[model samples]
Target: MMTLRRKLTFLVALAAAIPVVIMIGLTLKAQENLVLQAKGELNLLMRTNLAHIARDIYALCDTVNDVVAKDLDMDLAAARRAMAKCGAPNLGVESADWDAVYPLTRQARRVPLAKFMLGDAWLGQSRDPAEHVPVVDEIGREADCVCSVFQLMNEKGDMIRVATTVLDETGRRAIGEVMPAVEEDGSPNEAIAAVLRGETFRGLATVITNRMFSVYAPTQDANGKIIGMLCVGKRPETIASIRKAISGIRIGKDGYVAVLGGKGRFRGSYLIAPKAEDEGRNLWDRTAKRPDGSEHHFIRSMVTNSVAGGGRAIHFEHYPWPKPGVTGAEIPEKTGACIYFAPWDWVICATLYEEDYHAAADKIESTMTSLAVTLSLAGLV
Candidate 1:
């Protein structure tokens, strides 16, 4: 019932079709391999950037810490001289009788008070309360970061600004402003309070106006009683070159790298925020909805696990995200890599959008489908 010519045509078509199917299968496997490879590349990039930042930050912080330490010794010598006037080398931080301490009237604060001095020479402020002393201003000028001194005000554990390069909105030193005496929420401020407990604090901090990576150490007398606090700080992103490098990092079409604070005063705080709106916000508990409508705290998990790595390891996770700039539609699975930067107590993350990788595989699979249709058509003819 079949002609010899027709049967011959069928054999040729089958021969061509077998090779086409095999080639498509091989390409399909390669398409999957591409996605995996891409993911690994991004992960490596994230860590490389992390190491880069850590090196630079440690260098800067080291210089600042050394300067603060030397200044603290200088301050202790001067304060001991002033305390000798009061019949002791280690008098308390505050005086009950202001007249006995060569008292100078203070102004420019909300309420004027007697000036606190070290050795009757290094007055932390001018007659106006809002002025910087020689040492704090010199350190600020040399180090290019905020510098400050906060002396204990009372037995209530209040630290009043004695001198500082930190400014109010009007550009005057925020002298006499209280840091850890209280919080707006009526709770004890955790960061400075911890310093009051004799723990050295070194991480992200906000004193007065500048948010920065800072080190706070207690200034003690010869008797080893805590008298005041000394601080040195630097804004991590204020370096324009470093800021541009970090903000420019792109993981795959719409995916980006970000820096966050991992612990201490800045836990969950955004250091290098992707969205400007997220600046100064804590995102530890931020959540997204999965496809099944289940809630997922992906950020919480990512940061928590990365910090647990203790700056010696890396972590990977898959999470859900909406297609960037699209409404009412979200990708069900996105991949992220995170690591802890111990020097600054920072967490660095790189994330990849689902479509960026999957789109390649999907295109290959679609091509295979189209090829099958075309080959089948040729064989039927």
Candidate 2:
């Protein structure tokens, strides 16, 4: 057991092994530090992208909203008389039973058939109808967003799209459509309900083909009774220059930036994703099992934490799924940063796989193994 050659070989192997172990330990410590740093970077990336997206779209809506306050002044009585005489308000969609029954105490503020009687068809270009509404086209041109006027149909809180720069599915002017009193789910339509209460409703609302970041202001008569609603909005996805930038962001090797609608009807739905793989789908309803065998409602937790940040804070979450919006097939723990942009109800998220961040450690360990074998062979020689 104590042969001189065996003793010398053992001593040489031990010397090689000691430094390799020490070097590996040091590399691992450095890798751990790098990973912790990358997590912060991931979270920062989310907030930066979130702000980048929120700003431009918000500016578009605000600019149009501001221009409307000064330009849109309608005399409902004059509008109704002129329209009714000319057989206008002809493109109207019939409102729901809820609107027909809701007792709006200030129904007197509503001009008879006003919702059904559009003053003029302002279809992106100024054409003289019974009542001329040039602002719809003017503002739409100025800000490159949608502009429309919705006259209150009744005290039942129904509003009709009388003049609009908005186009229908077929690309013609979307006019005379009744803005319903409630959502398709029979729940109060938040934007419409807020306008009925004489407050500006600012969030996301449907503008023809998609939900847009929108602003809706109540038009009131001299007696302070709401007569109609002035609307302005733009699709966040089609926002002038930022959509491409937001969609192209990559947090790490496989990590990416994405957006989910955080409130109302769009809540639980994916607003942005790579290739639009699951856009318009509710991706937040499912629960997933984590790598640690714990049940996790990843999306719900991410959204709640982002909202809790109150628009100024950035929050991080450890999600255990490999893909965004999909449940099951747990990953090796992913970390993401999320922030809520309430204006459009978007939950902006940036995520990276935990293993990706520790790639340095893996590489170092691999290199150390090779180095250890080489050093031990040299010692044996």
Candidate 3:
């Protein structure tokens, strides 16, 4: 038991284990620090991206509103006349005449022309064929005003209905009026509703569906009746184009970018893997649950109450899962993930295999292990 060879072997083994343990501990600490740093960097990048996206959207809305407002004066009387004369043969009108009428019709002040026309058509009962007539009638009666409805051709060369209403300046009882029925989808109506409710609705970046961001704003008429809404919308392709452009910019291996809503919902996401579903999913709904019935610490950090203000940026964590719009705390962890939030409730999140982001640390740990083994062998020799 007291042999010199045995004593020497024990001493060498102790020495090797001590350094190896120390090396491993230090490596782990460094890795943790690196990961934290990476997370911070990614969050910052996400915040910046969101700010830019918001700015662009606001600008686009402004441009559209300005163009429409300047071009058409929000006239109800002219819209009424046009509706009455719709489908009249020859209409005895030229393109130039139609163009001339455009400015005059747009310039008319808001009035109850549609309500009067509707009452006249239905004898105040239900003359209009559209099912939305009742709703339009209700809006008209409540607001006591009317607005301008525009006819424009879509990419499909089909005529589309677009309407805009400003606060009534005249002491008229018309709140708003519906445009003549057009063939396009009802996205424009949704957009107008959002504006009326004081929400910002803008085109989002996604090719699969038309995405929009809704923000709230106040409305006031000449009599301060707050008669209706003015909303602006563009194609979702606007945001998709931006995301595609950013993808061309390199970050690191597996590096990506995303745009989130104030509610931490995915407005736009760019990842290596394709997404299964698109639109209307919330990020906070996803991150709060785990498979083993245990909650992830990272996701819990991102939850918070809604804040006021139009465009203030904030920072927080995100948990992905629950599939956006899910209610309650019971979510599967396989559905949970962590992300970072920026001001304005914009979020950017990323998760990849450890090797993708920490290659350098991995290599260093491997080298240290080899050194530990070599030292132990030399001691035996």
Candidate 4:
């Protein structure tokens, strides 16, 4: 027969081990399920957010195009002549001529060119108020008026440089006299060389100085010639505002949200305990070697393409997160996140932590196991 102490010890050990083992298994299973669900929800959120962003961008682009077209059709000669004169009569005649040119001229004239001009202020690059010129002068030189968003800077003696060209024939010549500015980088010729060679230019390009992101839409005129491109750029504050909005969303107590770019770059987030360095960094090209040398899991979902206003999905690999077990873990290295491309070719994605999201479930599982053990002990007694 076993000694009393040994018997008691055996019973207590069995009671504790069984519940603890069961609890751990249950907790792991619950965590996995919760994580999967959370991922689905995150993808849905991303899709919705992307749709809204695309809609707003397209609307803004349309508005800018209409505004430019109307401004170009007006009596630009009279406007310039009026600016030369210091009185409102020239201004009035100019305004009347503009009204006669287009039915929408009256409304267009009332609309400040300052609103559509690309510089810090509607003033373009000119510091002298008297030297104020229409931004159209810079826009009309291209085969198409579609040019990337650029900074208008003073080249010399307060002469502002117009970096891009516009779509008008006569207006193009006028741009030379009125603006007399050249591209800062002198690469416009190279950038549009393919288009000049009768090739279609499709894709995203950035204006280096302002770090402005724009989508170039190719379009042709009645002559089957690619006359112009429609260029749309997100405002400086757009991404910042998106980041702010995502940060405000609350998922569970520990759950959070993030907006990853189609290339799996960090765009914005509402993560708890998020890495400080990950913000505002592009993750598309840097996925193979993260600082931590850990594997990361990223979800790719097709959302919206800014340029075409369509949907597309594509997969990206070598995400930056550390694997469950990896040695020499340093700060998470930048890696390419996965992207989902849909039929429309828009991409979307998100990242999440499994443990953080299922904390509540883990606690609940622990409590239940403890209660079950207590009841088992009482019955044994």
The numbered model that scores best in TM-score is: 1
**Model 4, residue 77: C-alpha shift (Å):** 20
Looking at model 3, residue 24 earns an lDDT score of 62
- Counting only residues 3 or more apart in sequence or on different chains, how many pairs clash (N, Cα, C under 3 Å) in candidate 1? 0
Q: Give the Cα lDDT of each candidate.
A: 0.61, 0.61, 0.35, 0.34
- The digit string of per-residue lDDT tens for model 4 on 144-234 reads 3234322211222111123233222333311211111222323232224344345533332323212222343222333444433334333
At residue 159, candidate 2 shows an lDDT of 76
Tens-digit per-residue lDDT, 60-154, candidate 3: 44455454333233323333344334321111122211111111144333222211222223212222333233223333443333332222222
Separate clash counts for every candidate: 0, 2, 31, 25
TM-score-better candidate, 1 vs 2:
1
Greater TM-score among 3 and 4 belongs to 3
For model 1, residues 201-295, the per-residue Cα lDDT tens digits are 66556655455666676766567777677766664454334546666777657877677777654567777766656666887777887789988
TM-score of 4: 0.37
What is the alpha-carbon lDDT of model 2 when measured against the actual structure? 0.61
lDDT of 2 by residue, 1-381 (tens): 699999999999899788767766665666566656665676566446545544444454356545443332222223333334543333234332212222223132322352232444322222233334555655654564667777777566877676776766666666656666765436677788889887777666767547665678776644566777777766445442444666787766677777777765566677777666677878776677767987888888878777777667667777665565556665566666677766566777766676664665566556655665665555445
Clashing residue pairs in candidate 2 are: 89-118, 119-131
- Candidates 2 and 4: which is better by TM-score? 2
For model 2, the stretches where C-alpha displacement exceeds 4 angstroms are 1-143, 153-158, 176-190, 235-240, 291-294, 323-332, 365-381
Q: After superposition, how far is residue 294 of candidate 3 from its true place, in Å?
A: 2.9
